[model samples]
Target: MVRARMSPRVRQLALIGLLLAGIGLVVIGIIDPGAPAVADVQPPAQPGTAKLAPHLFEGPDGPETLPLDGAFIANVWLQGCQDCMPSFEAWKRLYEAGEIPKSLPIVNIAYGEVDPAWAERYALHDTLLVDSDGSKLVKPQAITTFTTLVVAADRKIVWRGLPRDPGYLDQLKSALAALPKD
Candidate 1:
C-alpha cells in the first residue's frame, strides 16, 4: 500500500471550501427553511386523478368540511410564505377580470392558524379556511409556497399546480368550463 497525504496548502483550501459551503447552506435554511430544493419538488398531481381528503376547516361562517359538494378551486398556502400574497393577488386579479367564473368558488386553505382578516386583505369574498384542527392535509401533497387544486364534484383533483405555471390559466379556465352548468 502506498501512503498519500495532501499538502498543507491543499488541505487548508479544502477546509475553507467546506466551511463556505456549510455557511451557504445555513443561510439558505434560515432564509426559507420550508422551501424544497428544485430537484426535490414533485410535479403537481395529474389532473382528475388525485383525491383530496375532506377535512374540517374553520371558515368565515363556521367550521366546515371542504370539497363542498361540487366543483371548486382550492388555493392551499402556508401562513408565512412570502410568495403566497402575490399568488393570492393574481387570483384576485383573475376573478376581478371576469376570467374566473362567479359560480366557481375559490377557497383559500391556510395550512396553519390564519386571521380572518386575510380575506379582507386579499379582497377575497369567497370562503377562507384555516387548518385549525391541524390535519395538515394539504401539506403532504403540496411542496411549494402555494398550490392550486381544481377539484371536481366527485372530490377528484381535476387540476393541480401553481397558478403561475405555464398554461395554468388556460387549464384552470378549461376545468371551470367543464363543470356541470347550473
Candidate 2:
C-alpha cells in the first residue's frame, strides 16, 4: 500500500501550533481562574432571626468582641475584593448625607488579612471588625464578596442581601424605619 507521509516542515509547524495552543490555555487560566465548582451558601436565606456569635475581631483599638446591644448594619466583605468596594462607598455616602440614621451603627466586618489603612480610607475606622481567621464568626463558604445584614436589637435579621440588589435602598429604608427607636 502506498501512503503519503507529512514532510519535515509540515511536522514542525504542527508541533509549534500545539505548543502555542497549550501556552494560550495556561495564560487564559492565569488571567481568569473562573468561579469555584461549588458556589458559596449564604445564611438566613430570607430575613430571619440569627445571633452573631461572639467573635474576637480586631478593631482600631485592637481586638474586641463587639457588643450587639442595639440595632446595627453589618457590612461583611473580603479583603482585596474589588466588587465589594462600591457597596461600602455607597453606604458611606448615605451615612454622610444623613440618609442613614445617626443612631444606627454600621459595622464593617472584614474577612482575610485586614489592612489598617482600609479603615481610614473607607471612613470606617470606628466600626471596622477584622475577622483574621475568616471563618470565626461565619463559615468561609457563607461569606461572599459582599453581604449586608440589617439586624435588630433582638438579633433578628430584618434585611439581608447584596447592596447592589434591586430594591436594596428601599428595603434598607423600610428595615431602618421598622426598627424601634432608642
Candidate 3:
C-alpha cells in the first residue's frame, strides 16, 4: 500500500504546537500545577492589627524582645516548623517594606528545645530576643502556633495568630501604622 504525505506547513504547525504545549506544561508545573484551582491557602496577615507576641523565647538569636510599642511587629515562632519558615519569609517582606520602626522588634519566642543557629532562618538572630522558657512571658491563654503580635507605640495589642491565620500581617501593619509617629 502507498503512504499518504503531509504538507510541510502542516508539519511545521504541528511541531510549533507541540513546542508551545511543552512550554505551557513546564510553566504550570513550576507554578505548582498541583496547587488547588482556587486560592486554598489563606494569604499572609496584613500590616496592622492585634499582635500576639507575649514574652521572649530564649534561643541562639540572642534575646528576641517582643514589640511593646513604637510601631513594631512581634512574631513568636519555633525554629523547626515547616509552616513558620514561609511565614518567616513573610516577616522579611514586612520588615523590608520599611513599615516597622527600627525600635520595633520582631521577637520570636521559640518554645521547646531548639538550636540557636535556626535564628538565621528569619534573619532575626542579631536583632530579636529568644525566650526558651515561655513559663514567664507567654500566658496560658496566649499560647498558639507561630503566634505573631503587632504592637503600636502606645503599647496596644492589635494582632495575634499562628502563620496560617488570615490577615496576620495586616493586623501587624495596622498596629504599626497606628503607632504614635516617631
Candidate 4:
C-alpha cells in the first residue's frame, strides 16, 4: 500500500519545530554546562603513588617537580575548554572570599596549550604548573576532568570535584582540620 503524503504546510511546520528544538538545546548548554563527568573519587592514593615529572614554567629558574610532601589544591585547566575560564574565575572568587584555608595552597596545572600570558590575564600567575603533554601527570594521578583535587601530604587524592557544590566548603574545612600533625 502507498503511504499518504503529508501537505507542504505540515512538512514546513515540522521542520520549524525541529529547528526550534535544536536551538533550545544549544541555549541550555550555553547556560549551564555542568562539571566534567569522571569516575567516583578513588580511595586516597597510597603514599607511594607515582609523582609528576619535573616540568618548566615561565618564572621558575628550571624544571621543577611539584613537591608531593603536603596537602594542596590542584586546579587543572585547559586553554580550549569554554567552561575553564569561568571555573578559574569562580575559584579565584572563592580564594578572595577567604574560603580557601591559609594552610592549603592552590596550584593551577595547565594541562594543554595554556599560554602563560593568557593565564595571567585570568589572574592565574601564582603556583602555575604548565603540563603541555596533555595530562601525563594528572591521568596517572587518576584525575579524569577539569576540576580540583584535594591532595594529602602523601600525594594521595583525598577529595576531588567542584568546591562550589553546597556544603563543600564545610567539607574542605573539616578535611583540613583533620590533617595529621607531623
Give a tens-digit lDDT track for model 2, residues 91-139: 6666667666555777888776667687556555557888876666546
TM-score of each: 0.75, 0.67, 0.49, 0.60
User: So what's the TM-score on candidate 4?
Assistant: 0.60
Which sections of candidate 2 miss by over 4 Å? 1-44, 138-141, 180-182
Candidate 2 residue 89 C-alpha distance from true site, Å: 3.0
Report the lDDT tens digits of candidate 4 across residue range 14-42: 99999999998788678755423345334
Q: Candidate 3 lDDT, tens digit per residue, 30-101? A: 986643333444443443433444444444435444544455555666577676666767666655676444
The C-alpha lDDT values of all candidates are 0.72, 0.71, 0.57, 0.64
Q: Where is model 4 more than 4 Å wrong at Cα?
A: 1-60, 141-144
User: What TM-score does candidate 2 reach?
Assistant: 0.67
lDDT of 1 by residue, 6-57 (tens): 9999999999999999999999999978656767655656777677777777
User: What's the CA error at residue 113 for candidate 4, in Å?
Assistant: 2.1
Model 1 poorest ten-residue lDDT run: 133-142
Candidate 2 global Cα RMSD: 6.0
Candidate 2, which ten residues in sequence have the lowest lDDT sum?
Answer: 35-44
Best-matching candidate per lDDT: 1
